[model samples]
Target: MDCASRKFYHKHEFDCRDFLEKYCADKPDMEFAEDALQFPTMSFHYVFSSGFVKGDVLIDISMGPLIHHLYSACDIFKDIIILKLNEGCNMETSRWANTRTGAFEWRHTSAYVSKLEGKSAQIQDKEMKLKEAISHIICCDFENENITHPVVLPLADCITSIWILDAISKDEDEYMKNLEKVSKLLRPGGHLILIAALNTTFFMTGGERIYILKHDANFVINALSKVGFVIEYYAVQMRRNDSTLIDYEGVMFFTFRKTK
Candidate 1:
């Protein structure tokens, strides 16, 4: 399966300020309780506070340059391996991790995560910690099922996949196959922290439209269970349909333990 997409991730402005100003606030489209703010805030709350297993390695198989989901895993895992589907995304994330000049700045995102955890005054400190925690960034593909290629890397204690399957799979069958590939990289009983946009058909990046799998919470739950994941925690934030910026009906986040 060819995972390449014509639309590149670097073309989009995933700026922290822009994201915060647009979706994180309580607007006419989103209420205070069910706004997009819940993703980052609640993700942090769940991973750190829910007795989730912490170990030597954590793999983040993100579809784009976004690293907001990595905030919670930084402190918990000793080594954070960011595996990207393309070179552009790999370089983008690595640039940020290495503090390179002109890197897509995420200090604001780090600051917000800190503020959510009652450490509002320690924004810079959080950024530094996240940078240190990230060990490497490399190219990987879910379809290949050999994410590390010639070198077989050690199985990770946990895997965090956010909005990746929707971007890669054309249908539920392919989605389930990709899920199995991801499951192979985790140790038995390891945790899988997944987040996805519900009922999303497409997303715009760099003026180009990218198709996505339109699935709801039940689809994700059933898929995970069939793939031998025991559901531990699940939640969803119903997306308000008033915004044209992104067309998604809702957001779903869940944590599951690999049963076999």
Candidate 2:
């Protein structure tokens, strides 16, 4: 995104609402819109209690509405490290993450993750802005030369994975592989907070679409344990509004502590 008046490069992002209302609204869909509107509350809870601060490195797989909260969240944190994994992402949010006081910006793009598709819905909201600051760096996807297996780097005080896990693999092994790769980013005792759509086979919102393997809370917990994360807190919701015919995501938010 250009600084003066702003012109973002990645213009084609999947709209969040379009996905929520389409395939996901069927039975065990997610209320991504409502949850997105609650960005203030969720960010407050995660940043405050989850130990996110100016020094934390947040390596997120996707940059859609899953990050809508961060549009405003950039206010409280600096030294932010982002692994965007796609180029046509919301540069506006990157600007917000950059301009905020003390917040340094960084990005990593990967086509493999983009192959995961539905990356656009990750940052669907247009309202996100930089209240104060510019990112430190933004890198397009580069090749990984070493480590056939996922690396475990102690690069951040906290690590977060939201909505990306389920979509990564329905096959247990592949999903676990992604989790292991993500765990390398955090130090032991560091926190990992995640929000994922549950019991979902497929969903659509804002002209963007996504697919899932249809798992539940227990499946996630077991996977975390295998990857050396201890479940600290977890919650799942599957309720439909009487006025609305749709049933929102049996969403699950889990907080885990890295235990050596």
Tell me the TM-score of each prediction against the true structure: 0.85, 0.60
Q: Write the per-residue lDDT of candidate 2 for residues 1-260, one digit (tens) a residue.
A: 12232211122344533432332232344433334324323443455444433344544444342343344334444444455434323343354444454222212111112222334343322123222222332432322321122433336656555566665454577677767767766777777767766676544435333445567888888998987888877766554332232233566777777886
lDDT of each: 0.73, 0.47
The residue-level lDDT of candidate 2 at 158 comes to 60
TM-score of the candidate numbered 1? Answer: 0.85
Model 1, residue 237: distance off in Å is 0.9
Clashes of each: 0, 28
* TM-score top scorer: 1
**RMSD to the native, candidate 2?**
12.3
